[model samples]
Target: MFRQATRLLVRPISRTGSRRFSTDLPVAETADESFVEAWKKVIPNIEPPKTPLSFMQPRPATPSSIPSKLTVNFVLPYASELSKKEVDMIIIPATTGQMGVLPGHVATIAELKPGVISVHEGNEVTKYFISSGFAFIHANSIADVIAIEAVPLDQIDSSSVQKGLAEFTQKVSSASTDLEKAEAQIGMDVHSALNSALTG
Candidate 1:
């Protein structure tokens, strides 16, 4: 039993040859260096690409930069007094159709019809009913409306418009000659438009 114990104690331990560790082994110290220095060593300095001269120039005036108010000149043959009135927008019943004009709009000339013209400034709107005219829109934010006949919308009487429309309609139906019928038809159209403007 003693001999067997001695043999077991003297036997060499078999190793799989993976790794071995000991407290007595020497360890090399790390060098003293900062992260910024390491980054600078890894990356080289490079200048950015040049930009074109046009890109550096001042930008041209845009639509939003233009003045929002429009100078209006509403006129009649007898009265050309409503001049240089600054308004935000103008809604006109043009011969082509109803059109809304704003600041910085392209220059145009439109013939007016018998309907309402709305002048807007901020939240408040002033309306006028015109018989016939022409409107000119300029590039300089100026608009001129030359009306043959114009009155405030509230000033128009509904009873008078109804009576006029009925009379013109009767004339249109009873006329004998073509010229008479044409004239009556025009009168009826104007009266009907006036009635609509008053009621609307």
Candidate 2:
């Protein structure tokens, strides 16, 4: 009697649920080696198919002690803001609230709102106003922050921000269609956050 070599693994998909993996359903870590080997033996001409695991970097194991620093990679569509920068802590504008992330933080994916992301390193703090994005915090003290539009707070023009805020406020009240109203509201939110980041 032969037994299956595959072992099952379960992981959380949401706040209160989990999904199970089985032999019938495959994952990157459980790619069918037997099938690949058979294919190689039969044809020996083509390369074996690559799994998602092969394309992804292996996750580092969690350390025993809380790390002193967190590795951050802040990225934008046009440029990479911070590449593997080690920082003491970072404050992100999450939808729920401003969340301060530190080393050894539990793995989470935070939906960022229009606000400022403050990267704190010792006594130096760098601030940037982001339109919106997501932050992925991993268990290995690494955080990947992705934003669509971000600019240094110092580089922003206060007068321009105020002017835009006024325009958006007028647009909000004058908007006739639902789409226009939503766009105006979004513009207002972003400007409000920008104003707060500058003033606060």
Candidate 3:
């Protein structure tokens, strides 16, 4: 069966004498023109259509071309309005990860961790330590940071943070139940973040 299959695969194809593969055929007379000649005789020259004057005019500027400022509304609970102004950029410490938002950033809602939020404008940068909250970045260059508690970098006292860290650490170590340990750990984390923010 293998020999028979090989013989059939290697078989030479027979060609009929009527079939022609070369371009050496005799041309028809001028009166009996071929299809190509008939097409060339009728079509003649081909030219592209001229563009209109309106199409040549310059296009208008796009929305992205004109630089826009990001409007930031950094608010806190207890009627504390930290900032309600426009900034160039905002670096948020989101729970998933850190995110930098600009004017044309895509819309998103991120849960902020107990970390610092940096607001940049021109050559100056302002930073604030936030407890926790949500940040909403809109498509129209508007960012709203609603935090539970927010304090300016300069306003936070290093000594107070160190003391709180020590107390929280003690509480975490002495925690008896799981719930108590979790609460104490959360407090310690916040204090640790506060200490870092102050020193960093």
Candidate 4:
């Protein structure tokens, strides 16, 4: 049988003298020293939360730096007092309803229905009528409003609008499919409603 024993030697030592302890067998002190060294190195790299209770700090959100000015292109004969440089807010007819877009707005794409398009340019407001089209605005404080058919208020004729309404009503009544019927009905109803509302 193997037995391990420890020995102790005592002597009168001075107050500043070093005391030593010895073991019967070899023991590793390097492991403890290495572990402590490793922990010290890892502590600085670990991140601490900004808050007192949190474990990690949150990253800051990226800022959107948008430029000034807006460019609008309309396929129809629409005119506006707003210049490409002075536009701030845009009010246009969307498939759902009227959409009001302002500066620093989030990016979006929308389908425009037939209705009056009002754009807010600084202190002035401009209005135009648009047919089926799409518009795109960016978070960068700029918008490129292009449409398929655009008609200025002064350029829009009552006779042509009335004719479109009558034809649309007929199409809506006899539409073969749900999709066709809905589209025709929406267009007709929107145009009719706009004529009444804007002309009033």
The candidate maximizing lDDT is 2
Q: Which stretches of candidate 4 lie over 4 Å from their true place?
A: 1-83, 174-190
lDDT of 1 at 108: 90
lDDT per residue (tens digit) for residues 1-200 in model 4: 00110011122222556542221111123323333344445454543222221232332232456445555434433643333554767787888898887766676788987777887667887777766677777545655666666656767777777888898999999999999999898879867965764576
**Candidate 2 residue lDDT tens string, 77-137:** 9999999999999999999999999999998899999999999999999999999999999
What's the ranking of the predictions by lDDT, best on top? 2, 1, 3, 4
Show pairs that collide, candidate 3. none
RMSD of 4: 22.1
Clashing pairs in 2: none
Q: Give the per-residue lDDT of model 1 (tens digit) for 38-82.
A: 333444253222223213433222344558698899999998746
- Which candidate should be chosen as best, given TM-score against the real structure? 2
Q: 45-118 in candidate 3: lDDT tens per residue?
A: 63222223213433222345424688898887785554568888999999998899998787689999999999
Candidate 3 lDDT (Cα, whole model)? 0.73
Worst 10 residues of 2 by lDDT: 1-10
The whole-model C-alpha lDDT of candidate 1 against the native structure comes to 0.74
lDDT of each: 0.74, 0.82, 0.73, 0.60
Q: Regarding TM-score, does 2 or 3 come out ahead?
A: 2
RMSD of each: 30.5, 6.9, 21.8, 22.1
